[model samples]
Target: CLTGAPGDAARNAAFLVDHSDCPAVSLAGDLSLAGLAWMFSRAAGVVSVNTGTMHLAALAGAPTVGLHGPTNPLRWGPWGRNVQSLLPHSGACAYLNLGFEYPDPPVTCLENLPVSDVLDALERMGLRERAFAGD
Candidate 1:
């Protein structure tokens, strides 16, 4: 399952999920914290773009993958068990400092990261086989 904020962002995410061959559900902000905890705890793994749910999923001991962009993973990545962070190479967004607030100059580091790199990161976390079992 994939969860994100409501409105356009979530709708865009849902559109991608709908088009992808991978089976997934795009959940908007509807679940309560407790409900989210319950869901995360039961998940085999969770993939997210540096969100609170990724942290919660990690805390829940689900294999959590936090895809980071210009932000420092050391400061904002998931904590606790079964967690992996996929960060872009530093040179891509060199001007951003560690623990910096939202960058003044918008960065597209995440967009630049290749899908193969993300899959490799997931493979390192032992998620690739399971993720593509049906494919």
Candidate 2:
């Protein structure tokens, strides 16, 4: 989860962990290059916005699923076979040419993307599958 540095991420993560049965890992606050490197080293896949961290994960050879909104995925999304990008409908925002910023909040476009759409994208990317041989 991409969380800005107010420290609420820890509280939110704790709540998620407590409420869910699946294991959850939280990395709160702004992460340094080394921190990002460490995360990429251990991750099975990366899910992030079109940001520097996403770029780092791409460079680290991790499969990255990028969430794009106002930004055009063709120009800004990660460049690799393992990269899968999802963009909102055309004309979703006028600032598509510009990089990510508060002016073109991705939240609106992101919210417009249905959960099923995201799951389908993940499934197409081969990131979603049955947990084991028998479940």
lDDT of each: 0.74, 0.66
RMSD of each: 2.8, 4.0
Per-residue lDDT tens digits of candidate 1, residues 9-39?
6675768767896566666676778888888
Model 1 vs. true fold: TM: 0.78
Q: Which stretches of candidate 1 lie over 4 Å from their true place?
A: 8-20, 94-103
**How many residue pairs collide in each prediction?**
0, 0
Over 1-135, each residue of candidate 2 has an lDDT whose tens digit, in order, gives 443344758786777778786445455576767777777766667777778777788777777778786667787888765888887654464255655454623445666655666666667777666322243
C-alpha positional error of residue 90 in candidate 2 after TM-score superposition, expressed in Å: 6.9
* Clashes by residue pair, model 1: none
Model 1 whole-model lDDT (C-alpha atoms): 0.74
